[model samples]
Target: MYQPPHFKEERLDVQHALIQAHPLGLLVTNGSSGLIANPIPFALDASASPLGTLRAHLSRANQQWRDFDPAQEALVVFQGVESYITPSWYEAKRETGKVVPTWNYVIVQAYGRMRAIDDPEWLLRQISDVTRHQEAGRPEPWSTADAPADFLAAQLKGIVGVEIEVTRIEGKWKVSQNRSDTDRQRVAAGLRDDAHEEAHAMADLVETRGAKS
Candidate 1:
């Protein structure tokens, strides 16, 4: 991850928060199968390690798990709010016509040694934890116990659990922080007016994160 000083997010809590909010991460590994990437939903246990621990499951048929190399580290990328920033939104565009379009986003990258677990007990716990996290806000939440025992057991046989003790993590929040105050404010206003959920989220980031500039 490129780290420009102005955009770096160094707080561990902030990094973990982004991962929890965007649990679906792009798991990247380089092993016998070469570079392979899969989109997997993960559960983060902040207390599990100094950095954190990531728990996820992959279909038994997915070769990525089998290709895991203990000698190499794995990377999981979590992407948060992202939106396009138009030059038209910058006051500098009108003042000097020197502004260019760019992107505003928040993202976190976690790197750690990969471990694959085939034990049924671990798999059960991994799935339950992930399920509980995702269903937390729902009016009618579902649970792994809701399924028939035999059926759930049979289904669990088809997947494998993965755990990664995150050793390194990086966060970048590029929310118009490089722009001048007037330009950043104008960008936020334009994003808010777009009336889209993601754009509005980016607008809030611009207001809060860019304010530190």
Candidate 2:
């Protein structure tokens, strides 16, 4: 959460959209016991609202769900592509004696209060919707009816559904935004040639975001 001005991402709409492309977020909440974090694959519904909506489920027996009091806000973290910045990538460092290691990546943070969905039918609907979303481009799409009604009903009983209506979001795209154009170009080119897959990912992020401006 400690982000410098140079690394902060200000485009809210675009930020929201980016995370949804990979909506598996780390959900964190706090209560009397302590802080709890759950890595959940979520269904992000943009049409739900300007702040968007998050839908996910957890094991019914998992006490964490009950401890997620609606009064206490929750944080959902969507981690985008990231890569390390090698010292050799900086053209400025090649001439000047100023250089260090850093990382470039995109991440979105969503804050909101969570509410439990008690309606089994609504939960079923959400489950179906999420399945469809994930299997959108798959040749063999999976449907909710894959399981027998009795089986699904029993499975649903073992899970607790949740909805998080986002209240605030912080998007940070730390891709050498503060660097000079020449420095950025040098870094991008170097990263593109990097053997590490993560490095190439960072290069692509820089180019994609840079073009927008």
Candidate 3:
């Protein structure tokens, strides 16, 4: 991930939390086609291993899964809020005119061995967990059981289950951590005023992570 020491996130708990917060991961595999990346929403089973396991599904028609070898490694990229940091926000920029624009973001890369599942029951369970997690706070939550059995069965048949046994995980929190406290605060303040939701999110992360350091 090309993370500098100041930007590296070494906390396991923090990395896991980021996955939970941003469950949509970019699953990447290298095969005869070179490389293919699929965006998939995953459910994490933290108890499965020290680094945790990932559960997702892809369309049965997707050839990326078929081409990938289970013995080889796959990478799941989880990205959180990101915002553009303007030099205009920095006090040092005005003092020395040396600062340039940068980006503030959080990213986690999970490396693991992936196994494909064809069992309908296991696929149903994976769908249920991920659905429940996402639908928790909705005004009217939906469940797999809400659908007709035959319809649900047919739906499951069209997709293939994916399970990843995580071997390692890396987190990078580039939330203005390299800047001084004053500059970090300034960046956060600027982000807070931005219209984008992720900008506001990055502002909070900048403040939170900086406080920890």
Candidate 4:
């Protein structure tokens, strides 16, 4: 998360939105055994802390959870739109041959002390929230209640829930903000032409950043 001032997104609202929009994050922790990271979906619990909290579950067998002591800190990285920026997309660079390639993207890093939530009732609620969030745009929505009694009980045994009450957040949004208007527009157009989702997303961000500027 080495963000230059030109690309740093210090807006609190933007940081929260990024984390909420992208629930899946890479949770990294440093404990007695050293560093460990896990990619998991987390729900934002605004009521839990002043800076808000994260809710996620890891498999009971996963050692990553055991390493997260209440006294230690962990980093949850929430990544938004990202894409490669080609030099050819910049009008100024194309004309003068002055610019090289770069990347445009948005990311938020949440640092906090991790806490394990072992209560069965709370874990169930957290699981339901996560499932609903992930299945938002699906055609056929699934639910924890859809499964049977014994089956659900057995399923719950394999998982453990945890929350990281976010103490610090750092946001980065590199969306061609440093580029000239003409070049930015060209970059947006070029991004739109790209076949990948991330490229199109970057194009949208470029447009939004331009509008805000």
Candidate 5:
């Protein structure tokens, strides 16, 4: 996380909001198995600690859980709106022809001690919480109790729960903030004209966040 002074985001609530909005995090750990990374959906407990706590489950067969080193910290990266910016979209490109292409994105990185929990009760609760959070706004929300008890029990046996009490977190919002006002506004307009939803989201960020910066 090479953070420039202008792009650094230190607010705890902002970091947590990004994690909650993008729950699928890239879990990175360095252990006996060397460097391992997995994309896992996590549930955040903001009040669990001063920073926050992350709860997720991994397949029992996944070696990352077994490879956890208590002495080391694990990292989870949550990505939000992201888009590629073209120099053609910048006013500076026409004014001085000095602009180059760059990427714009919002991301959060969290670090904490990683541990695995093999208890069935904890796994059940972890899964249920994650499921409920994901299904909240759906018209037909499903629940863990919808499945047969035996089937649910059998399914639970195949996974292990993991907990991380966040010790450090960093957020980077690179949304054309470094550009001049005119250049940023032109970038946002270009992004909004793109067809992808993510680009549109990035356009909004560029306008709001760039203005603030």
Candidate 6:
């Protein structure tokens, strides 16, 4: 993550919140075959480490897990609200015609040594936690316990548990903080009018930053 001073988000609470909101992470690792990345949903356990620990699962058929070495480091990237910022949304564009388009987004990169667990008990708990977290917002939540014992057991056998004790985390929140108040406000307004989830999310974040200033 190339984090400029103005864009870096160092607050632990904020970082955790972003990870929670964006549970899916791109797990990246290097092996003899070369670099491989897989998108996996993670469960965060803050108590596991100062930076936090990530829990996930990979398909047993996925060679990346088998190829991954415990001694090597892996990176998990979590992306939050993101949207394109057009020059038309900037007041400075009209004032000086110098502003160009850019992007506003939030992202967190976690680096740590990954451990692969084949224990059925650990796998059960890991999948249960992930399902519970993701299903919480639904009108009718689903659970691993909903399946029959034999069926769930067979399903669990097809995956392996993954855990990472995070050693480092980098957070970047590029939310128009570099722009003037007027320009930032205009950007927010433009995003809000776009009527897309990501756009509205970015707009809210930009507006929140303005309020703090």
Better of 2 and 6 by TM-score: 6
Model 5, position 18: C-alpha lDDT score: 94
Q: In candidate 5, what residue range of length 10 has the lowest lDDT sum?
A: 204-213
Better of 1 and 4 by TM-score: 1
In model 4, the Cα lDDT at residue 150 comes to 88
For residues 101-173, could you state the per-residue lDDT of candidate 2 as single tens digits?
A: 8888889999899988767897898889778888899989889998899999988888888899988889888
- For all candidates in order, the CA lDDT equals 0.92, 0.83, 0.91, 0.86, 0.92, 0.90
Q: Which sections of candidate 1 miss by over 4 Å?
A: 211-213
Candidate 3, 151-213: lDDT as tens digits? 999999999999998998999988887788999889889988988888888888888887434
Instruction: Put down candidate 5 lDDT per residue, 112-136, tens digits, no spaces.
Output: 9999999999998988998998899
| TM-score of candidate 5 on Cα atoms, chains taken together | 0.97
Candidate 1 C-alpha lDDT tens digits along 132-180: 9889989999999999999999998999988999999999999988888
The 10-residue segment of model 1 with minimum total lDDT is 204-213
* Cα-based RMSD of candidate 2: 2.1
> Given candidate 4, what's the lDDT at residue 89?
79
Model 3, poorest ten-residue lDDT window? 204-213
lDDT of 6 by residue, 78-196 (tens): 99989999999877677799878898889999999998889899999988888898899899999998899999999889999889999999999899888888888898889989968
Candidate 4 off by > 4 Å: 137-139, 211-213
User: Which regions of candidate 6 fall more than 4 Å away from where they truly are?
Assistant: 211-213
Clashes of each: 0, 0, 0, 0, 0, 0
- Model 3 residue runs over 4 Å out of place are 211-213
Candidate 2, residue 24: the lDDT equals: 84
